[model samples]
Target: MTLELIDIAVQDSQSHPRLAGRVTGHVRAVLSEMLDGREQTHELSIPVWADIADGTSQSDIDLALMLKAAKIVARLKLSLQSPP
Candidate 1:
């Protein structure tokens, strides 16, 4: 489904530590796959959207993906820099 139709509803934690931990782990797993590594220290705030069948459209999703790749490349460059 298009991101426009995929409503990301934030659910409240019911004060259940176990459930919260599981959710967090799952989210990390998915993001980790996207980041090309098991660990990622970078922080990115991207609001993404995609075109739907409607007359209007949003290209945020593509922007977000591009940003993510750029972040990884930037961090890799920094890692390769010599000590000042």
Candidate 2:
């Protein structure tokens, strides 16, 4: 399976560029791991937006993004099995 990440946009009030980069990195890793070895022939474009509030911990952000990535992968798998 081929996976391409077009873009990741993060919005926060604190304007933490470093934190945003970390979040996107974590997200990309999670998505890559989840989509690895999948039998996806066509392209699937999934746009995910995450909002990080002030005072949120890094672990919490990572967990939430991982869950979101899992959900996206699960939904895609289901859709691929359905008839057109």
Cα-based RMSD of the predictions, in order? Answer: 14.4, 8.6
TM-score of 2: 0.43
> Which is the leading candidate under TM-score?
2
TM-score of each: 0.32, 0.43
Question: What digit string (tens of lDDT, one per residue) describes model 2 on residues 1-84?
Answer: 344333332222233465553334333422332245664333333344456776778666755665666577677656655365
Clashing pairs in 1: 49-61
Instruction: Report, for every candidate in turn, its global Cα lDDT versus the true structure.
Output: 0.31, 0.48
Pick the lDDT winner.
2
